[model samples]
Every structure is written in structure tokens, then in C-alpha cells.
Target: MKTEEVLQHVTTPLVNPAFAPVVPRFTDREYLNIVYRTDEAALRAVVPEPLEIEEPLVRFEVMKMGDVSGYGPYTESGQAIPVTFDGERGEYLHAMYLDNFPATASGREVSAYPKTIGSPSLFADNGALVGTLDYGSQRVATATMGYKHHVLDLAEAAAQITVPTFMLKFVPGYDGAPRVAELVRTEITDVVVKQAWAGPARLQLFEHVLAPLADLPVREIVSASHILTDLTLAPVKPVHDYLKGVRS
Candidate 1:
């Protein structure tokens, strides 16, 4: 390819990209979010600088993508910590595990999402809504909630999902030095809340060497919600450049 063609390439492989260059839209994107308090020290350790913590709360979420625009159906599970950046409240995405390669690649490469390959699933088991994450053969996390016990306010559920999400984008150079290091932010703009509910819930995190979600132990289950919506993820924009004003 010519130099001009290379400059115009959006993603890797040049000839055939891993995923199409389109903002993903979801139809009936279901979410099982369990917000709980954790150790303050653990939150301090992982939550990067320039971001402040207020209550040491973490949201464990499992998302079931019913239909997507570019990538097909997939399930995802991850952890996000509530934090403040420049005095604004937002959630810092800690880790995300999904079962789809295109979604994973696009998330990490294009948007700098902390995504990796794992086995995560969400389904109704009898009367309970269950979400689980597994690494290889061992189960890492499991969350169960009473199905549709109480109707949740539409505005409340919409507020929770609309919060801005912060992520650390770190890419190393060929010589093992940092290439791209920045804090990026994004939020869902076109969200149509289809249904939402609240209920009693419980979560369990097991010890795993690779997916060490148990590092931030769950102290107390504060709240739980089951929400279904159709939304589109906005493109990410960098908020802070870590390498700025540095001497080489």
C-alpha cells in the first residue's frame, strides 16, 4: 500500500480489518448490574491517578448483546469502579471479558477498552437471573438476582447507564516503552430504555490468577438492577495524556 493509503487506514492488517469501522449499536442490550462496596485500599490501588474515589464502590456487570450492528450477538462481564475526574462523577472501567473476537478487538484497538477473551454468560435459570464469568475451566464470578421483583423507575435506570465511562489506554512500543498512554472517556447517547427492574441480589467472586476480580473483595451489596435497552456507544475521546510535558 502507498504511504497515503497507510495513513488512511483506520485499523490493523491494512488489507482486511478485524472489525468494521462503525459505531456499534445494540438492540435489546440487557444488563445485570450489581453495585457493592469494597475495600477502600483496593480501590486506591487500581484506580489511576487524576481520578478520585468517593465511596469505594464497584459495579459488577454482565451484558448480553441481543443484536449488534457490526459484531453479532455476544455476552460480556466486567467490573467498573465509581470515581471522579476533574470533580465530575464517572465510572472507571477496570476489566472487561467477552466471548466475541470482533467486539473484543474493536473495543481494545479502536476505543482503548480494557477487553479480553473469556467465557461470560447471562441467562434466566428457573426464577433467578444469573450472570457468570469463567476463565478457561474455572469459574471466576457469579451473580444472582430475583427476577423482576419490583419495577424500577425509568429515569433512575437511565441515569445509571448514562454516566460517562473512563478507561486507561496503554499501548507499548516495539522496544517495550510506552507508545500511547492516555485516559479516554465515552458514554452512550442514544439509549432507549425498554424495561427495568430491581430486586434482591447476591454476588460471589472467586480467586483467579488471570482474572483477578476478587482482588477488590465485595463488602456489601448496595443495590441491583436488571435493565434492557437499545443504545449506541459514542466514540471515545482522550481526556488526559500521561506522557504530556515529559522530558525524553
Candidate 2:
């Protein structure tokens, strides 16, 4: 194929391409987020400088997506730390574990999402909403919450979506060297909150060689929330281009 023809190919072309498309819209997404108070020093060690942490907090989420536009159904769970970029409150994604391979590739390349392959699940059983993550046969994290014990205000729950989400975009060079690195920020807007809930919950993190959730070491379970919503994942914007600054 000619160089000009290669530039016009989309969907990754099943071979080699610069980037791929990941425009997925989720419906009836079962989301459970657990906020925990972690050690300030530990949080600081992971979160890069220039992003301040008003409170030493981290949020872990497990989501079961019903129908993804191109990709079929899949489950994902990950952790993020609350931070402030340029005085704006947001969450920086520390790690993401997913089950689908296509979504993983598109997420990391297109949006620079810190995605990795793992076995994660979200379900409701015995009047409780449960989420679990496992690397191989070893369980890494488990979260359980009272099923819709208390109804949450839709507006209040939706407000959280307005906060920008941040992640690192790092592309290594061909020789395994660092090629591109940047801080990317994205937002989820026009959220239609079908239902929301809040109640007492518990989270447990275990140590595993591959998927290590216990590294963060949750000091206390601050709060937990269950939000059922339909939302669109918008395009991301690079707030800090590390390569540009270095090249200059």
C-alpha cells in the first residue's frame, strides 16, 4: 500500500496504523465507586507534581457495560486519585483493568488511558452490589455495597461527572525509549442519570504479583456510591505536553 493510501485507513486497518477509533457509548452501565482515605505521603508519591491533592483521597470504580458501540459487552474496574490541575478538581487515573482486548488497545492509544487486561466483574447478589477483580486466579480487590439502600439525588451525583478526568499519554520509542509523554484531560458531559444510590459499603484490596491493589493501602473507607447512568465519553485534551517542552 502506498504511503498516501495508508493515511486514509481507519479502524486500525487490522495491521499497522497510527491510531484507532474507540467511540463507544454505554447503556445501563452498572457503576459502583468507593472512595477511601489513603496515606497522604503514599498518594503524593504516585501523583505527579503540578497536580495538587487537597485531600488524600482515592476512588475505585467497577463498571459493567451493557452495550458498547463497536466492542461488545465488557467489564472494567480501576482506581483513580483525586487531584487538582491548575486549581481545577479532577481525578487522575492510576490504573485500569479491563477484559476486552480491542477496547484496551483503543483506550490506551486513542485516549491514552492506563488500561491493562484483567478479569473484573460487577453484579448484584443477595441484596448487595458486588464487584471483584482478579489477576489469574488470585483476587486483587473486592467491593460490596448495600443495594440501593438510599436513593441519591440525580443532580448531585451528576455533578461529579463534570470534573475533568486526567491520565498520562506515554508512547515509547521504537527502540523501547520514551517517545511521547503528556498529561491528558477529558470530561463526560450530558450525563443522563437514570438512578443513583448511596449506602454503607466496604472495600478490600489484596496483594498480587500482577495486579497489585494493596499497594495503595486504603486507610479508611470514606464513602461509596452507586450510579446508573448513560453518558458519552468525549475526546481528550492534552493539558501538558512533556515532549513539546523537552524538545523546545
Candidate 3:
């Protein structure tokens, strides 16, 4: 193929040379987020330096994307740890497991989202919003929240969604060392929360070698929320590039 032909192809070049739009807007999404207090030491251990952990908090969410623009329907479950950077508080994406590969590839390449292939699901059970994650034959995490228990303040929730989120992007070098090491940040925009609810919830993370969610043991279930929203994810930008000694 000629140079121009190769450059025109979409989703091919593992890492794009220049910024090209890769939009995957979600229209209908059902979300369940469970916040829990975790081991203080574990919370501190994974949080990178300069990113402070004010609360021993970890949030596990299971979302079902109904109508995605580029990608089809898929489910995702993951954990985010509450952290602060340079006095700005936000959540740092720790790990994410999804059922779709296309979304997985784009998320990693575009946003540095730590997405891996796994069986994560979201459904209703006994009138509660249920989220589960399974790795092969082992079930690693399960969360259940009371469905639409209390009306949530949409304005407050929208503000929360606008907060900057962080992720660690690492592209290995030829020798298996990190070629690109960066702390990336991204925001969710054009968010319209059609409905929201809050209620009690429960979470359990089983021990598994592949999905070691139990590494951060759940100490207490703080709260849970079920939300329906339409939103777009903004392109990710690097907040810190370790190799280049850049920080912002």
C-alpha cells in the first residue's frame, strides 16, 4: 500500500501518528456505581506520587451501553479510586474489564483507559441493578444496588461527571520496558442525566489471579447509584509524561 493509502485507513495503525477523531457516543446507558471504603494502605500504594488519596475510597461501576455510535452494545465493569492531583480531587481509573474488543482497543489507544477483555455484565435482579464480572471460570466481582431508591440531584451528578479523571498510560518499549509512560486525564462532556437514583448497595470482590480485585479489600459499602445518561467522552490528554519529565 502507498503511504497515502495507509494513512487514510481508520483503526489500523496501532498508534496514530496524528490526532484523528474516533467518536463513540453513547445514547442510552444504564449505570450502577458502588462506592466502598478500602484498605488505606492499598489505596495509597497504587496511587502515583503527587496524586494524594484523601479518602480510602474505591468505586466499582457496571455500565451497559445501549446505543453506541461506532461500537455496538457492550457491558463494562471497573474500579476507580478517589484521588487528588495538585489539590484537584478526582477519581483515578485503576482497572476496567469489558465484554467488547472494539471499545477496548479504542479506549486504550485514545484515552489510556486500562481496559482488558473479560466477561462483565449489567442486568436487573430482584428489582435491583446488578453488575458482575467474570474471568474465565471464576467470578471476580459482584455488585447489587437498590433500583431507583431515591431521586438524585441531577445538577450535582452532572458536576461530578465533569470532573477530570486520570489514568496511567504505558506503552512498552521493544525490550519490554515502558516506552511511553504518562498520567493521562480525560473528561466526559455533553452529559444529560435523564434519570438518577441513590440507595444502599453491596459489593464483593473474590480473589483471582487474573482479576485481582480482592487486592483492595472492601471495608465498607458507602453508597450506590443507578443512573441513566447520554454522554460523550472527550479525547484524552496527558497530565504527566514520566519519560519526558512533563507534569501539569
| lDDT winner | 1
**Mind giving the per-residue lDDT tens digits that candidate 1 earns over 181-207?**
999999988999989999999999999
Instruction: Sort the predicted structures by lDDT, highest score first.
Output: 1, 2, 3
Q: For all the candidates, what are their Cα RMSDs to the real structure?
A: 1.1, 2.1, 3.3
- Per-residue CA lDDT of candidate 2, range 1-248, in tens? 78887776655654754333547787877789999998888888889867889998899999898887777889999998989999888999999999998888788877878999999999899999999999888899999999999999999888755578998988898988678888989988657889999999999999887786787888999988899888888888989877776663
Evaluated at residue 22, the lDDT of candidate 3 is 55
lDDT of each: 0.95, 0.86, 0.85
lDDT score at residue 65, model 1, on the 0-100 scale: 96
Q: Return the top candidate by TM-score.
A: 1
Better of 1 and 2 by TM-score: 1
TM-score preference between candidates 1 and 3, better one = 1
User: What TM-score does model 2 achieve against the real structure?
Assistant: 0.93
Clashes of each: 0, 0, 0
Report the C-alpha displacement of residue 72, candidate 3, in angstroms: 0.4
